[model samples]
Target: MTTTGTSSSDTTATGAARPGGPGQLAGRTVSRVGFGAMQLERLRGDRRGALALLRRAVELGVDHVDTAHFYGNSFVNGLLREALRPEDGVLVVSKVGADPDPGGRIPLRPAQRPEELRASVEDNLKSLGVDQVPVVNLRRLDSGPGLRAEGDQAVDIDDQLAAMTAMRDEGMIGAIGLSSVTAEGLRRAIPAGIVCVQNAYSLVARDDETMVEMCAAEGIAWVPYFPLGGAFPGIPKVTEEPAVLAAAQSLGSTPSQVGLAWLLQHSPNTLLIPGTADPGHLEANIAVGAITLDEATVASLDAVPSRSADVRIG
Candidate 1:
């Protein structure tokens, strides 16, 4: 791992015009309801279908897209390259740290050594066909088998931040973001000028409530990975809850839509990146920004067992 420790300001394309909907992301105004490309890997060999879905997202005025070169072993980024143009006004946010091995399973490890981090950023650039990534997140593994048992040596947050900061200074990346981070991690990352934090959070998976409020206060974009019951395993499923179902029926909205609506109203800095390879689901996910929930409904939804003790991440 090379540790040159040269940090600089971001040099990505500036002045991205905001699309109609919720406000700014990382100081650049954008649609609050963003699209996540992780689920596209499940499409298998349907690359054409994946491309079409991405294009449809753009057509629907989605200006923010969350992706990673490691997703689908670089397949998702390749699809994004073919589907959308750089001038389309889409702010592509990618991550480095988690990589899918040849077996197609991303074994969690502390691979954020400076040189590896730089190489991962370059890999994202090459796969997405961009000179500088619009936003690159340094994903930290907060919980895993070996990682949980071993502790800090598994992943040094400062070293990883230094590497990303170096890349930003070198004009290889735009803004910097972090994923799967705790409040302490955020505190350590603040000096690095972190623009966002992507963590496993939702109605049921509400372990990161403090982190959410911290991001809101610090003006950092809180990108929740699984707004629904998807992504992280072991967290209590929100969609299957009785209150969620009753509220969905009362509001005449799908459970998924209700969950997303709650998130949109949860915090101003909260950015939704619900993933779906299905075109129909994609439309529904974007439309979630419009569903307004009353205070009574919000209170009732909160009553569901969302405490951290009830949630678990694998």
Candidate 2:
């Protein structure tokens, strides 16, 4: 298994400042810096290692985890079911709108239709052995880092929400969130009580700056996906930035830590789900919530400017 930089003792020594800190999310308090389970895809062959990695993250005081039924075609969810315990109190968040493209060239195929999304939720519930999901992010595939909706996959936001609302009413899901959606779509979903929004966002990818602000204004958790960009178009590598590297050197921390710290400091409502199977990296990512950047350093990093690119859905 693995973790970020700070050890459990190191985090405890500065618990107030570290412990990956907690923030409000859908009426529940969860770590501001949580874990994303995508990286576990490769660890499937090593079940023990995968379980330990997930357990290690929880031990580091991570109380939030972003996952999806489509990830590894639900293989990751099986790991979560085995690794996480009820007393852990981890707010396991899942997303719908794509099904695993099993035996296909692509990793995922669009499942944007309302019924498909409902089926994905059912898959999550069964795979995780949970009766009701805490929060389910409806992934609108009008845009992509992965799959995009075309043909029959092009479904309206209102219709997708209708299905989600029905499930929520039946106690099938605790809360609802949006993923890969637009400002206009978010605005329309206000009455639906969206608890969060997930999009490809980071220090360099500021195209969603306005939307982040919008979420903040409305008290919605802006749970950005690729906070430390990974081969996404127009999103630069945070580790490669001179300012980030210099800051990391000065702070005596890794560039990845600084990059993640910037995200925590970027907005009050922001929550992180940077994922990794490597223990050191996991601990480093969680430790980011504790690393505070000085105003000068933050300004320098900010000056790097947002390389806005089109990743939109209306």
Among these predictions, the greatest TM-score belongs to 2
**Model 1 clash pairs?**
none
Q: Tell me the alpha-carbon RMSD of every candidate.
A: 5.7, 4.8
Candidate 2 lDDT, 1-314, residue by residue in tens: 11112222323222333355657788766668788999999897899999999988878877778899888888999999999876666788999988887777767778888899889999999988888988999998754365667899999899999999999998778899999887888889989999999988888777788888999999999998888775555557888999999999999999988888999898999999988889988878877877999999999999987765344322
> Which candidate comes out best when scored by lDDT?
2
Runs off by more than 4 Å, candidate 1: 1-20, 104-110, 143-153, 230-233, 307-314
Cα lDDT tens digits, model 1, 1-314, are 01111212221122322222655665576778878998998886888899889878877767779998878778888888888875566788998875556553343444556777888898988998878887888877673111231433355788888889889998889889998777898998998899999887788768878888898888999888767764444556778888889889998989999888888888888888888989999888877877889999999998887734233332
TM-score for all predictions? 0.88, 0.92
Backbone collision tally, model 2: 10
How many pairs of residues collide in each model?
A: 0, 10
Q: Which ten residues in a row have the lowest lDDT in candidate 1?
A: 1-10
lDDT of each: 0.76, 0.82
| Model 1: lDDT to the true structure | 0.76
Q: Candidate 2 at 61: error in angstroms? A: 0.4
